[model samples]
Target: MKERNHTTLTEFILLGFGSGLGLKEGPFVVFLVIYMTTTLGNTTMVFLISANSPLHISMYFFLMNLSFLDLCYSSTIAPKAMMSFLAGSKSISFHGCATQLFFFGLFASTEAFILAAMAYDRYTAICNPLLYPITMSKQVCIQLLVGSYVCGGVNSMVQTVFTFTLCFCGSNEIDHFFCDIPPLLSLSCTNTDINVLVLFTLSSLIIVSTSMVILVSYACIISAILRIRSAEGRHRAFSTCTSHMMSVILFYGTLTFIYAQPSSLSAPAQSKMVSVFYTLVIPMLNPLIYSLRNKDVREALGRTISSVFLK
Candidate 1:
């Protein structure tokens, strides 16, 4: 067995999507458009939730957090990716990559917790309507929001520390777009068994536990809805959950596929596309999905537009 040198690598070249794809300026333009749209959509959602009195509730509170998370999450990766596409420079400094990984992990883990909190909120609202206000009080909501961030921060810290500690002796070209765990692990010259174990354990705990919360909440919500004697009541109750459910499915489905498997088994191309969908596309879709499907949001937007025009 040969001993590996622990040479300090200062920077890494992110071979984003690779030149072999033959994507010219068109993809850059498209990504720019998506980034702008994602920013606008999420910003609008946050603004609407904040400004509208009708939306000053627990559900919307959680929603506003989600919008903010999406905005930050997309920003962490999109701008850098777009710049690489335009400038044909794929290099990212060691610290720059670490920062990206930290924030990306932070927002991503926080969003998962927020979704679970939202599911619990829905559960309370529908299943225990009489106690909903007390169950999801202002203090409780604040606690939930704070807890989500704290959990995310802790998770991000652990993963970032574990990842960057590894020795990259020779190759510094990252196969994917951003600074992610799997690709980084693939590049490490030293043994990564412990890192892989920690990655799998932490990621699985976050995803599976939060997913279970959502599943149980929805199960209870459904049971309560089914007991509603009025068809209109049942429909209305179910309608409130549809948007969150869809977002959850889209997010968790992609994330589980990408992160749950060992890095050695992941196909770089397929993983990149999946990453694009959840990281970029999902953020843009979230606001649209919620606003377009909910009449209240549409009315609120209309009111906002009319107020500005009338002024």
Candidate 2:
């Protein structure tokens, strides 16, 4: 048993880019731009999906929720991170850190499940088109969405309680931009074997399970596409899923690299770099990835612009 002084830690100093990472002004400006892009892009996605009647399907419903999640995801970490760089304000209250960790977990977990749900939607649409409406009915979609959020909330609640309850008698410095589980676990003075195990277990359960759903969904989707007799039909079917495939690959790849392994095997700089990708870059990229490959989105955007300008 490790001896801990049991002194209450009311706050933590975030050592985000504080150890001579780079000039503050440059990174601050870049992050500001990234945050703004994330906001605008995802907000536009949500609006376009919601306002356009043609886009009112299970796929677009999932996409709208995805955009909302990306917006929340980036907002959770980017604002504080940008502030840290520009304002030189690195200290965060204990409750504030907990809140941040909770929302970060909630949104990230929800997005993972939502991505799986989207994969499932694509699978049903392509693999079982005739049954798509019945299988992915409006009621079912709402249930899936609500279930994802609830599971996310539960995961965050458990993780937050586990993290904050750990004894922090030593340094209160968190070596990342936000209060993520890995960094916070490293800051604990008490024995963290349980915490680490819990983090890894819960993370694996959510990530691996959802990843399996995606993998299985895509596998079926591809098989069904291959069975199509016409080349044009095959292309059209596969095209609809490409955007989602890219999103899943980018999101799951980075997240797996970070959470799938224990922190001991990861260097702080390397970990932070990976974290920045999923937390900031990926959110900004998701809307672009979906829209650029999606004809419906392009046409809708053009129509919206034309309608507004020609009036």
lDDT string for model 2 (14-71, tens) is 8786664344787688889999999999999999999899999999999999999999
Q: Which residues of candidate 1, in runs, are more than 4 Å off?
A: 1-7, 19-24, 263-265
State which candidate has the highest lDDT. Answer: 1
Local accuracy by lDDT, each model: 0.90, 0.89
Model 1: lDDT to the true structure: 0.90
Kindly give the number of clashing pairs for every candidate. Answer: 0, 0
Models 1 onward score TM values of 0.96, 0.96
Model 2 score (lDDT): 0.89
- List, residue by residue over 1-311, the lDDT tens digit for candidate 1: 13444336788887777744334476678789999999999999999989999999999999999999999999999999887776656788999999999999999999999999999999999988899999999999999999999999999999999999888887888988789999998888888999988888898999999999999999999999999999999999999999999999999998888887666336888888899999999999999999988888888899999999999
TM-score of 2: 0.96
Q: For candidate 2, list the clashing residue pairs, or say none.
A: none
| Shift of residue 202 alpha carbon in model 2, Å | 1.0
Worst 10 residues of 2 by lDDT: 1-10
**Model 1 alpha-carbon miss at residue 93, Å:** 0.3
